[model samples]
Structures are given as structure tokens and as C-alpha cells.
Target: MTETIAPTPNTLPARSIAPWLKFTLELGPLLLFFFANSRPKLFAPLVHPFLPAKLLEGESAGLFTATAVLMVAVLVALIVSYAITRRLPIMPLVTAILVVIFGGLTFYFQDPSFIKMKPTILYACFGLALLGGLVFNKPLLPVVLDNTMSLTETGWRILTLRWGVCFLFLAVLNEVIWRTMSTDHWVLFKFPGTMILIFIFTFSQVPLIMKHELRGDAAAKAPEHL
Candidate 1:
């Protein structure tokens, strides 16, 4: 019997993914993967049986293997970055750790809910960590966001407070999706919904941030007389 594999969809880039779209595109492989593997009856005579039916309620044939491949690819990317730059990466490693924890659970239990629940767990953990930092008089946001946005200690404090709250809100949203909505609806909204919420929330603070922003070269360069 001949075996056939579906072509990779053009959802996410093979090498790297943008921060915003990463949530959506990265899941593509899984959605394609499960759909292809889940109902062997659907593929029938066209595809081989090596791809068994889902192991659990939503198990995809070799679901574990598919998830592993995606995660390993991310690990490789990190390794390559270290080799080129010779610096320990924090965010990528954090992301990789999350991938391992969530993806591993999905595979181990053969439960689709594990995958669905990953975001809630991640957001909750992050929110708690940020709030903890506030208690310690530290702003965790600067740790994650300093490269992109630099601000004074006071700014960091406010930013951390805001992000901590946002993350908590996201956690609640995820819970609602998983508990009330269908798995498909939750999956569909996970990416776009998060992107919109985050984008809006993030930018909404810009005006306040600008108001509190300490003067920089732009301000200094203004006409002294004016």
C-alpha cells in the first residue's frame, strides 16, 4: 500500500513567526494534522491506515509525534540563535518551556482539552508572576519588554500593573471559551481574539504612557526659546 502525506499549508513561516500571528499560524499544523488524522474513515482508501484514528476523544493518529515535531523545530530555532549570537535567550526559552509543558500533556493524555487549556494556564501563570513582581517592587514587563519599549522605573511599575491585569482578563476569557463554547469555537477565537484584545489594550495605554513619558532627545531638541 502506498502512503500519502498532506502538503504543508502556507499559514506560518517555516523559519520564524511574528509574535502576533504566531498563536494562529503555529496551530495550523495541528488543525491540519488532527483533521487529517482524526477520521480515518474520511480519508478512507485515499490515505493509509498508518495514520490511526484519534487515540482519545480527539486524538489524532501519531498526535504526539506531530506535536513533537513542531516543538522540536522551535527548539532548533533557539539553538541556532544561541550558536549565532552566543547569548542566552529568555523569551524564546520561556515560550519553549510552555510548548513542552502543554504539548507534552496533550500527547501524554491523548486529550484535546490539554491543548485547549494551554493558553489559560500560560496566561494565568504569567499574570500571577507579574503581580508577584509588583509585590516585590519590581516590574516584570521590563524584563520581557525592555528591548521593545524602555521606560523609567515608575513607568515600568505602571506598565507591569496594567499588563498583569490584562493577562488575568485573558485567563478568564480562556476559561469561558473552554467551559461554555465548543472546542472549535474556542480554537477559532484563540488567535484572532487574543490579537485584537492585546493590540487594543496595548495601544490604549499609549496616550497615558506618552503623558507620563519622561522627556527624551526629542523634547530636548525643541527650540530653547519656544
Candidate 2:
């Protein structure tokens, strides 16, 4: 599968997504993924009569099954996003591509490692992209976040640094978790646990954003000022 690089966050000029709708579009697939993994036996039978017997007769069949379902769910979510806004989001689109690739490998080879490694790949890509942008003195956080909130250059730099570091940290965390713990634990961490950490980190940044808040006409100020 070919992976498409997502547009910088908040950079896409398009219709606004309602907070609830955006959340549903993003998290729905993940929730389905967690359910499939956690209840593979239940899921296996549900899909059993439909799939060929040869595909579901192995020690790792449950995980393979879950991975397959997860792939479908991801595709569905992406389609829904496009139907709603008439535009495909960068991050989710990139993620769906990875899911198809790794998830396909998992189903084909009957190995769970490929699917397990998807998050690590995604996090590393995002983290490196942000940090690399900073190295070139081009803050790309605005690309992703410009529409959500306004921030001065300093604010963008700080937020970018934090998110960059966080993504890298999550990459390491995923590696450690999947390698050391059960799949169920990893699935839990994948959603709410990761969500909580991100929310907290984001919450901590409100003060910085406020401190650097641009007043009236500041955003429209001369390009040189920017």
C-alpha cells in the first residue's frame, strides 16, 4: 500500500468539523480495534462463516482476525471523514495506509508483530517531522494547529517542541508496552491511556498560549512581524 503524507495539522482550509463528529471519526475505528482484539473468540465466530476455513485455523488466528477487522474499520472511518467534510484528513489517512500495510502483513503471515508495530511507526514519523522542521527553523505546528488556536511564534515553537517530544516518548512507550505486556494492556494504552496523557500535556500549555495571545489585528499584522 502507498502511504500518503498528511497535510500539516490545522493547515487544511476546509469546513470545520464538529468536536463530537471529529472525535467519532477518529476514535470509532480504534474502539472497534480494541473490541476485536479483546474478544477475538467472539469476533472469530461472527466472521467465521463468511471467511474461508483455512484463514481462521491457527494458534494466532484470533489476532489475525482482529487485525483484519481493524483494517476494515479504519477504512470505514476514513470514508466517513471524507463524506462529512469532503476532504481527507492527513493523520488518519496516513494511519489508514499503515494499517492496511502492516495489518495485511499480519493477516498474510499470521504474525501479530506487524500490526503491533503500527503505532510506533506512526509516532516516530510525526515526532521526527516536527523536530526536523524545527531544525530547519520552520515551525510546522502551525500547519497542524493554526486553525484550532492562535499563538505567537514562541508559542508555536514551545508547543511544537512538546508535541514532538511527546510523540517520540509515545513511540518508546508503545515499544516497551507491546514487548513486555499482554495485547489487551497495549490496546487499552492505545486509546484512553494515550488520550489522557495527551490531554494533560495539552492542558498544561493553555497558560503559555494565553501569555502569547495576539491581540486585535495582531494576526493580520505585517508579514515581517510574523
Candidate 3:
């Protein structure tokens, strides 16, 4: 007779978002950013009512406009996520903090590089945190993911390593792109391109997760009830 484990839950603890809400919350800010950066003049009037006149003018208008809008949008997203879930997802919170800091610096210095480098810094931090946790015999993915995934310790370790390496790779990639590519191109890559890559990478691990899923005592005990 063959034995089988019950399918593990894909939903993360305190991190579940309804598909529609998740799409809106995650993509809304990025879309706004792209539009603001690409068509600053068009967005300027809409945002100008809220922004200082100093930020609405000069050669830095596009970048500044986008950065300001991005910051506000992220804050709103975080609030909405918390309102809906009653908990904040760690990665997005971390990303939001970086956006605020770098976004503020970008405005203060009037240099777009600070905002451009936000992703590189964010990815590097995540990569380092994941890898560092493993070195101490702790897998941080479950914590970061807040998911109800049931994996063996070994499975968790492997997934952590995979994600750690992927994040570092993304960090390097962001650096390369922002340094060599145009601002508009980088903005596109930052939001849409990076989001697609992450979605693909996440789904790619489903097979591995299923293979190593651990059946809890409750699952084993359930057979007695039958």
C-alpha cells in the first residue's frame, strides 16, 4: 500500500489576501508610479494639489513626482493590507520602509539614484536575512512567509537557500539594470518585470514543497476516525 500526506495549505498565516484585493494593493502603486514617471505632466495636476510647488517643477519633476506618489501609494497599501488582514506582511513592510527612506532622500537630494537603489538594498537585505538564519540552523522563510505550509525541517532549509540565492541574484540584477538602463526602463523593470519574476519563482517551488510536505500528528491520528 502506498502512503500519502495531506496537501499542505498554500495560504500563509496572517498574510492571505483575496486575489482581487491582492492584485489591487500590490500593483496599484507600481502602476501609479509608471504613469507618473512616464507622463509627469499628466499626473502633475492631479498630484499637484497635494504636493508642494517646489516638487512640481524643474528637470527632476518626473522622478520626483513618481517618487512622491509611490511613497503615498505604498503607505496606503500597507494600511489597506493591515485593515484587511489585521497583520502586516514582513517583506512588504520592509520594502515600504525602504521606499519611504529612499523616496524621501530622492526628493531631498533631488537625485533619482537613491530611489533607484531601493530594490537593490531591499533584495540584499532579504537575501542576507534568509541565508544568515540558515547558518544558525533556523529557517526564516516560514516566518517571513507567514504561511501554513507544512514542510520538514530539511524542506524548509532547502527552500530558504533557494530563495536566499534568488534574492541575491535579483539584487545584483537590479544594480546592473539601474546603473546601465534608462530611468523609465528601470521603473518598468522594477515593478512589472520584478513582480513577474517573483511570481514565477514562487510557483516553481510548489512541486518541491509538495514532495517534502510533512504530515502532522493530527493528520496521522485522523485515520483512526474513519
Q: Among these predicted structures, which one has the highest lDDT?
A: 3
Each model's lDDT comes to: 0.62, 0.79, 0.85
**Residue-level lDDT tens digits of model 2 in 144-180:** 6534556688877888898899999999999999999
Which 10-residue window of candidate 2 scores lowest in summed lDDT?
Answer: 217-226
Clash count, one per candidate: 1, 3, 2
TM-score of each: 0.65, 0.83, 0.83
Off by over 4 Å in 1: 1-73, 80-85, 215-226
C-alpha lDDT of residue 163 in model 3:
100
Candidate 1, 1-226: lDDT as tens digits? 8986654543322343356554443444445434433343444443333323444224343334444554655566666655544543565666667777887777677665676677787888889988999898766775665234545567767888889889999999998988898655665566457767888998999976776564677444432210
Global CA lDDT computed for model 1: 0.62
Candidates ranked, most accurate by lDDT first:
3, 2, 1
Model 3 Cα lDDT, one tens digit per residue, 32-121:
898888889988877788667877887668888998889999999999998778678787799899999999888778688999999999
| Model 2 residue 84 distance off true place after TM-score fit, in angstroms | 2.0
* Candidate 3: RMSD to truth: 8.1
**Candidate 2 positional error at 173, Å:** 0.7
